[model samples]
Target: MLIKPVQDMLLHNADHYLIPADIVAVVQADNNLYHAFLVLTKIKYSKIPVLDNDGHFEGLISLPLITEQMLGFDHLNTEILMHMHVSDVMETHVKTVQAVSDVEATLHLMINDPFVPVVDADGIFQGIITRREFMKSFNFLTHEIGKQYDMIEKDFSSSEKTN
Candidate 1:
């Protein structure tokens, strides 16, 4: 079946699906690696958004990025590394989607990232939509469609019997 209608229906209430920024764990660009590491450990999140001091969205940081940098050092300099800023290792090229974006656009952005950061028209950080959430919504829509198909089949069968 065509998914445009489903996409429209889902995107109509897209704001409701967003995980607001307030609830998300975000590290500041100037934050030390030690702090970033601690937050990542505490949250147990693979990746977390980075923000600047002005509360503008910066990029994303992941545990692997930290580990990759750490691996380059023959001698683990915990003290020096601890002072490294998040911006030094954070990925600047990030995929972002607007809060009002359609599901198809959001899904396309999410293909390369675990979660797509949601922003406002003014480029203000709003929240994120994770792959998990998207999958859950898609599954629900498919399940509901299946039920509707079953009902239609039953109705058709009943009409045939009557005729």
Candidate 2:
């Protein structure tokens, strides 16, 4: 019996997360305007949750939002710094992915919304894996089974030694 490879499906769906770093934006309340600008400059594709040291997904700082805030704040003496905390801005109750889910579920997620948050089962924030990255990684898997074989070999060799 032939098992269908999920990697094929993931690769086909890579376009869902085609967002580039050019579009990604990160912001935290602790970050100054300058720092937020730098983060925007670095990750230009999507808006990432502003994370606390404890790894909670805080507020998001996208370029468009920052620009609007900048315009609103230009005439005021109030510090833009006051708005830097992500907890004040990030969308709470972010949708997330479970690692054990199949490609069909992931595709449905991406199709419904491209910005699903990827998290561990425990709800810890892992790196956000975009639909594009997921597809790319799966495509890479399509090329060869060498890595899987190597891992299997290593496990067998270790087991033999132990025995």
| Best of the candidates, TM-score | 1
**Mind giving the per-residue lDDT tens digits that candidate 2 earns over 94-131?**
56655524455666667755455555565545545466
By summed lDDT, the worst window of 10 consecutive residues in model 2 runs over 17-26
Give the C-alpha lDDT of model 2. 0.53
Best by lDDT: 1
lDDT of 1 by residue, 44-147 (tens): 99899999977789999898887766664467555755868999999988878776455777878777777889877776788889887787777777666555
Write down the lDDT of every candidate, Cα atoms only: 0.78, 0.53
- Reference-based TM-score, model 2: 0.53
Worst 10 residues of 1 by lDDT: 146-155
- lDDT score at residue 5, model 2, on the 0-100 scale: 51
TM-score of each: 0.80, 0.53
